[model samples]
Structures are given as structure tokens and as C-alpha cells.
Target: MLANPATALELDHVSRHFDGRAVLSDISLSIPAGKITCLLGQSGCGKSTLLRIISGVDRPDPGGRVLVGGTEVAGPGRFVEPEDRRIGFMFQDYALFPHLSVADNLAFGLRHLSRPERRERVAKVVERIGLGHLLDRYPHSLSGGEQQRVALARALAPRPSILLMDEPFSNLDQGLRERVRRETVDILRETGTTAIMVTHDPQEALAVGDMIVLMRAGRIEQVGTPFEIYDRPCSAYAAEFMGPCNRLTGLWSQGRIETPIGAFRADLDMPDGALALACIRPQALSIGPDGQGISARVMAKTFTGESEQIDIMVHPLAQTLRMHSHVRIPMGIGDKVSLQLNGAQVHVFPEEPGTDDPLDQS
Candidate 1:
């Protein structure tokens, strides 16, 4: 078993480059012990590269440092091989040995143990995963879900200091993927092992991560709990990444934003007349009384399984505001509806210089 350290991982000024291009800028993160942290971002966003560096499969540039359990693993004039770091990695592909049985594969990392000790460790893990009956089976004979469990079992068999997973459940069908994900998170929490997972799916990150590290363009965008990241994104880009949103362009003044739809209260410290985005999440709009809310003409309506997506054009504003609202309304195209924004919180981001409005390109 790995030693219990107060801090599981820390990165100090970590950066990576390739062929004169910087793939990861100076990124530093402190991960807590026995917690699940998710590194989430779109493609080419440097999430996977960061994971590789953490696992010692990729090295950071000079002057960068990586520490595991408060021990310096990588730094100037110091290096730790991937195997010496005591990190367990579950690659994008399972990377299981087709020629080896489940038991042998689980026992692969226990070479230092005696034969009896190896068997005992493997048995304990296999039974913990409820797969003892399949221990003698080969990888090819198992289903994808079963194979995933076996890979997890093998990674934990040696009980490394940290575990890294890259798109671990993307290979399975959606239904099976959710089930496996729930079970995997349960096991991780139960074992109290520090773990990090890389994923592009925001919902998946929210569902499984204790803390979320959102990245973009080779930099950290936001770091917080799932609730904090989703409920209070710091920027328009960060807000859009979490889910669909309806953005309104308006002038900020006196803690309120004046828009064509209506004057809504906003919390911002920007000077008066500064441009900003009033981000309304899809679920924030509710159908209000006909005479008391913003007037809109329905342009389109899409029926998603659980709720309806109603596209509206808010007239009488400085510009025609295209808005999307996910709500239940038995209305059709050309229908006139009133919408009132209601949420526990409202998000407003100051517009950047030289940046176009979010809806301008829509």
C-alpha cells in the first residue's frame, strides 16, 4: 500500500513544449489527498498533456517541478522514471495483455512479492471488484465493461501512490458507461486513493469529480468544486463550456444591466457603460404572465426528450436578441411568449477588448 501523505500531488510552474510550440503554459495545480480531481477541456486544450506529465510519461520543461506526496519527482537536475514514481495509469485504451489471464495480468506488478503473497493480493482485488469467478478468464473473453473493471483491479492491485485515468469509460455504450462510471467512483471513494481523470464531457466531470480543473488554450480556466464552477463561472467562455446559455449584450450601471428584454440586476464592478454579457442558463428562463415579462416571438421549437428548447427573438431591445430557453410550454412557432429569468444566481462577465459579442457570430 502507498504511504499516507497529507498532500497527494503538487506542480510548481509546470510547462511543456514541442518543436518551438508551447502545448502547456506555466500550469500549477495542488491536488488534495484521497480526493478525485478531474482535468476537463476540449481537444488540444493541454489536458491530456498535463496528465501525461503527472504520470511521468511526459516530462516538463526545465525549471518545472512535479511533486508526489511532498517528494520531488521531477525538477531541474532531478528526474523520476515512470515506474519509480509509483503511479498507476489507466490509458485511453485498456492496454490489457491479450495473452495473459485476468489473474496473471493483476499479478504483473507484484513481482517483488512471494508467490503466495502475489496470489493473495490478486484474489483480494478480484473479489473486491466482484470478479473472482472471472479471474481465470482471458481479456478477449470478457465484455468491455468487464475488461474495464479488470483493468481497474490490476491498477489498484499494487496500490500505487496515485492513479491517472484518461477517458477511461469512453469505449462503452452510454448506458453501460454511466453504470460503470458510478461504480468506479464509488470504489475510488471507498478506497480513499488520490485519483485524477481526464475527460471532455462536462456532465461526466460534474458527476464524478470532487474538484474540477477546467482548462482552455493550454491554460487553466477555472478551478473549483463542480457546483462552484457551474453556478459561478468566471468568464463567458467558462460559462459556455459548462452548458448551453443565452447571452445578452448590455450596458452595466448601478449593479444592473439594461437590456431589450428587461432591466435585470447584475453583480459587477465595471464602470458605467462598460460592455458585458448577461449569461442566462437554459433552465433559468420560466414562462411568466403575459403582461409582466419580456415579450418574445418564438422562432423555433425543438422537442428534446425531457424538456422543450424554445428559440425566441426578443424584440424592442437595442438589437434582436436570439435566446434559447429549455422549458415545458405547449407553444408553437410564431407564438408570443413572456419569459422571466429566475435563478439562484446570475452570471455576468466583463467583455474583453477587441472581442465580439457572443451572439454576434450566432
Candidate 2:
């Protein structure tokens, strides 16, 4: 696997519609050469649809063009057929031929190469993926993770410039998913094979991709590195969807916000006397016994060892505020407690104009 700095991918105004409904709208982004980008969203968010269009399995209408290595492979009324596009795709279900042996499956797309070259490539990728001993076994005899690796080896064996994975690790258990995800990224980096993958798991996207693009209703909501997107989300949806966040509605004051919990200064400037919604990561909060901070009652508790989540019912306001604590607080349900914001910065968004539900349009 050779690194090619010349292989860059770009999508320009990509729009796809089906049966009078738009699946993707005006999507545009360029993937850095030799970098892995993940399309992240829940089911039906159009991530998979966009991946298909890029793979040339599905074509989009005018303005949708997938360029690989700076060459247009798909565009208005034109599409290079899937095989001709030279883009490798790993299906969600593994898609390994049931009757084909692991070695045969890995060699399926290498028909265009010399016999010796194909064998060498298959042997190398199979060994790299740790499927060396099962090369003669059929797909039915392999476990879910092994099957996934087989699919990956087959895709990589073709030496495609870009690899498109559709929830490739969805079938694996949680522990297996973590191990395989890390291994997969390491292999991709070692090979320097640029990739674009679709997954709903934010953790997976963060772990596997060098950059993550959050998609909603076929449109890109935000694009950034995992830490940037998680720490500084651009929207309420991104904040909540990416991880556990405590979103609170409050009135913004001069460089501060007054919420049910209490008033806290923010680093990001906000207009005074404006309605705003503040987002605080769970790990940013601290909890203790009733004290000078805003008063609340512990409604529920869940211990996560490193941190325990304390759900509290705030007084007067009656809003529930959940805070995180590192200690094993013995507070049970209905116990009085108080919480405080332990940080100097929080992310806030202008309250949406009508309905309180931020996802009304979604």
C-alpha cells in the first residue's frame, strides 16, 4: 500500500432526489488527500445514499459530481459505472459470496491483474487482516468479525484509491467493534488509502475518521475533527446527537447565562437579555451536598465508576438537571442536592423562534 498525495476527493453541490423527495441537498465538501472522512448521521439521514452515489451504484441528478483524484466520475446526466470508477465499497452486511472461500473472495475483484500479482495481493491483505488461517474456509464458517475483515481485505485487494464502508462494523459486538474499529483505522493509515464511511455511531465516526461530517435530512450540518465537533457543536442537534450533553434554556446576560441551576459566566460572548440555550458536557459539571449553589433534589442516580450521573430536580423552576460526579455519592432518589457549573466556558445557541423542539424541521 503506497501513499499517494495526489489522490484527493471532492463533492460539489451534490443533490439527489427520488420520487419528488430530496434525499440530499446542495452538499459540497472536499476531502483532503490521503485522509479518511466519515459521514455521520442516523438512519435515513442520506449518508448511505450519498455514499452510493459516490460509488457510482446510484446516480444523482444535475450538479452532483464525485471527483476522485481530481477527475469527475459522476455528474449531471453522466456516471462512470461502479466498476469503472475504481472505488472499493464494503457493504454493511459484509456481502461476501457464501460459496466462495476467503481466498477466492479476496481475489474476486483482482481478475484484471496477473495471476501471481493477484495471489500476492490477496495473501498480503488476508494476512494483514488476520484471516490467514481461514483463507480456505467459506463465508458461512467465519464469525461476524472475521467476515468483516474478509470483506475489507477483498475491497483493499483491488488497490482502489478510495474505500467506502457502509456501517462495516455494525454486526460486531461492542467490544469487538472497538477492537476492529481501531485495527481498521490503523490498517487504513498504514496503507494510506483514503476512505469515506457512513455510520450512525458518533463514537465510531470519531474513532475511525480523521474528519467527520454530520449529515441531516440529506444536508451537511457540520464538518470538523471529532474533538471540535463534540466540544463545540454548531447546532442543538449536533450537540445532542454527538454525545451526552445537558442542554438548558436560559436568559443570556452580559457574558453570562442564568439557568435553573444558576448563573454562570461564558467565554463566548452573547447578547444581553437574549433567550438562549446552553449546552454543557456532562463531564464539565460537578456535584456536592446542598450548599450555596442552586438547590435541587436528586431524582435518580447511575454509577459509571469513573463518573456517576446524578439526575436532579431543580427547585422553584422544577427543571431536571443532570450532573456528573467522580465520587460515589450515596444520595438516593428524592434526596436534596445542589449542583454547580465548574467551568468558565459553555456553548450557547440563540433560542429558535417558534416551537421549542429544535428538531421540528427535521
Say which candidate scores most in TM-score. Answer: 1
Model 1 lDDT tens row, 41-126: 88888999999999898999999999998888999999999999999999777999999998899999899999999989988888
- Each candidate structure's TM-score, on Cα atoms with residue i matched to residue i, is 0.92, 0.91
Candidate 2 colliding pairs:
none
Output the worst ten-in-a-row residue range by lDDT, candidate 1: 353-362
lDDT per residue, candidate 2, 1-362, as tens digits? 23235557778899989998999999998887677899998777899999988888888778777787777888866678989987999999989999889889999999999999998998889777888899899999998878888888899998888899998888899999888888888889988888998988888888878899999878999999998888878877788778776777899888777887666666555678888877777766766678757677788888888888888776665556677878788778887766667553356777765523323334
Pull out the clashing pairs in model 1.
none
Q: Please give the RMSD to the true structure for each candidate, in Å.
A: 3.2, 3.2
Local error of candidate 2 at 228, Å?
0.7
Model 1 misplaced regions, further than 4 Å = 1-4, 316-327, 343-345, 353-362
**lDDT assessment of candidate 2:** 0.82
